[model samples]
Target: MAQPPPATMRAIAIRDGGWRFEEVPVPVPGPDQVLVRTHAAALNRADLLVLDGSYTVNPALAAREQPIAGMDGMGEVAAVGKRVPTTSVGDRVMYMATSAFADFIAIDHRLLMPVPLTLSAVQAAATPSAAITEYDALIVQGGLREGQHVLVLGAATGVGVLATQIAHYAGAATVIGSSTDPVKRTRLDRYGVHVAIDTRRPDWAATVLDATGGHGADLVIDHLGGNALVQALSATAVGGTIVHLGHLAGRHAEIDLDQLGRRRVRLIGSTFRTRTREELFAIAAETASALRPALTEGAIAPAVDRVFPFSQAEYAAAYLTSGQAFGKVVLDFA
Candidate 1:
């Protein structure tokens, strides 16, 4: 039998204008929630934004005295609420939820996904947010079809690596990825990128067009916005879709409306920040269903760049900010 949870837990939270460990009350599961004893948590760019007060998905977090600073984690189910029948104590699970930088999280059972047997706790923690984001961007929003040409900007990023792999697993004919760093560009091929373009080159779009035999990409999963987005318009095939997932380069972009209209291109912006609980549940369900086979078989896995002990979370965040990691940065609690 599992031991009862403690009254309080250590969590990384915003305090004194920076991230610090704080003792907070352990959350009690509601009727539909599950209490997970987290073993690992994955750091995302959004965590940085949350710390800096630039963005927040949960408005209530801002009003809290010490807002936690994580988005996803993996652990064992310590307890379950009355209404959550599908999950039980001892189930290994992963989920995307607010306040996940703590040792325990009480999340809706519907939000939890069983960790694939092939993955360790840390790898499982790395998968949920990136996998779900790309599955939605590539399959749902971009309308990816088998034999299509797919392009991913910032392909060395945590989500970018998964986007490339997801496109490849979906049977894309060509997977082209871009990274400004040549060193990172070289690493993309192992992650399912058939052609790696150095975005630093002025003619990178031409390279993409050439690689596609002058046709351009059928679907572009763009992580870099600003000038990169504008250039993507020129590299996109007629009727292609561009799903803008992030703006790591620059947020503002001057698009060429004439080119967009002539090409009949579809530009879409996606984020989980504004989604309702029901909408997120549906997305999580769809993502799990579509990617479970690959996940279970180890055909698709998160590329974990580094693992930091939970105590070194500050260094992990700094490492991620330095652009030194090729994939997801994870914080291991054990």
Candidate 2:
């Protein structure tokens, strides 16, 4: 453990239904936890849900009475609890934790991943949650195989970019991506997306089928749910898998179950919030290990769109909502 820590530190606080920066008490690490001085934090769409109170994090685990919002960050281990054995003080680390929109965060040491020297704090902060989500969806759940035709729906989002790269590295025969943004769609080719389809077109599924020579995608990772999910069924080949990971399109949609049944397509819904702490730690560690080679070789890296200072969290959130960012938006405390 380090010497006695400060009484309070600067943090992005949610008060009166809005975001504001304030000084809050520095959290004490529990027996199994470590105190991190966060250098950079990344925002996710879920953060907006949390802000609007649509997605409730366990109140018992809330960082303060009002709760702070953020999912993952990169920082230095400033202090270790008496029973925390894995991380030492002064270590550079990154981890997914609740209430990370602050200058400091106290998290379970088990969830931590050592930051690779090659990655800047911004790059490392951009990983963790996004990496784990893609690893689970494409590798563990989707069983994406080499030479398989894969389609990434909503491939302009943060997780979408990572999924495209992962599928390419997995040796997919054709990596197709769908995005509503015309400019982003064009850049998808630079990120391992072999074919970029405009989701605005009602016949994008037909285009995907044509790209695969009338054989639909072997794996369809759907980030847009609702009507888009129904369309994904049309893009999936018989016996293929469609991983429904996001509902950005909406929650409900009308679809033909007969088509789903006849095609023998498997639809899976995955979310990290439901995983046990131990399970999440395993996923994080495994993803880090699996991507180390790619990370070291420059085959995979964070596509950071913009960075905002800790005090400008409101502007950052607004920028994310503007939908101009093609990659992860980060909040830098340094």
Candidate 3:
């Protein structure tokens, strides 16, 4: 109802090329922006590299040369500019933020979307980045169609879950996923992941073939690079797609061109970092329609494996690398 105090707020900042938590001025919104008071922020694999001096995707700031690390977050609208017609104070919002580890963020009005009433703050925060990354690859790039089969690598991670759902939503006949853990495997069915095989087992590929009756999946989503590419190549139907989204397994990819050309396969790569806010908003709007029912009726909940207070941001970063969690790991600033 009233303006927040003028004093600075506690934020997780990276300065002197090191990760930190410090008191920084809460950002003020420009004419085309909104100010969000964050309730929760999720850790992304990208967030970990930025703190280690290995990430390079942050928007180049005039005052700061070093990249500020953050990609996904959830918060409430604390303030909005006069020109922003769609949002007002106290509206629970979720969107991409710059250096989202902070308690407050100033972002383009277009990037913020109203959180679905059924989704909690943590669940809302988990959806934007991961959902869009999968959307960009399978729907936009892979040309996934109804009746086609889809295979998603890194099936226990966030994007994998979204891909599995999107494939089913698109009317795929069957959707398969690869996960090493039995616990995580059980969660896939709700998302339309029809058959989830443990990649740790030597027969994972055989299981996919058996499930498809040797016709093979029409599309394969590879968020885990390296040998997963070879595995995708093997499981693909003669002219299928393999959408490359990450290097979770490792960046280096080894493949045989002769084998790939024989199948008329297509390979595409995606990074949501390069896409514009308008682009992201369009996809979110579509997903929002699909997400509303499931989000409200408990068909889906934000798969948050853990949450850490803002003070333990580094532990949150480490948790992502540990690969022990099934869902997202978040930092609670409120």
CA-lDDT, candidates in order: 0.90, 0.86, 0.76
Give per-candidate clash totals: 0, 0, 0
Clashing pairs in 2: none
- Between the candidate structures 1 and 3, which one is better when assessed by TM-score? 1
Candidate 1 lDDT over residue span 75-103, tens digit each = 99999999997898999999888778899
Q: For model 1, what is the error of residue 261's alpha carbon versus the real structure, in angstroms, after optimal superposition?
A: 0.6
Identify the candidate with maximal lDDT.
1
Winner of 2 and 3 under TM-score:
2
Worst 10 residues of 3 by lDDT: 58-67
lDDT of 2 by residue, 1-334 (tens): 4566689988877776677778889988888888999999999888888867777664433434547778879999998889986778999988877889988898878778888788899999998777778878999999988899999998989889989988998799999998898889889998899999987789999999999999999999988898999888899999999998888889887879999999999989888767776777788788878987887676877789999998888899999999899989999998
Query: Each candidate's TM vs. the true structure?
Result: 0.97, 0.95, 0.91
lDDT-based ranking, best first?
A: 1, 2, 3
- Candidate 1 residues lying further than 4 Å off, grouped into runs, are 59-66
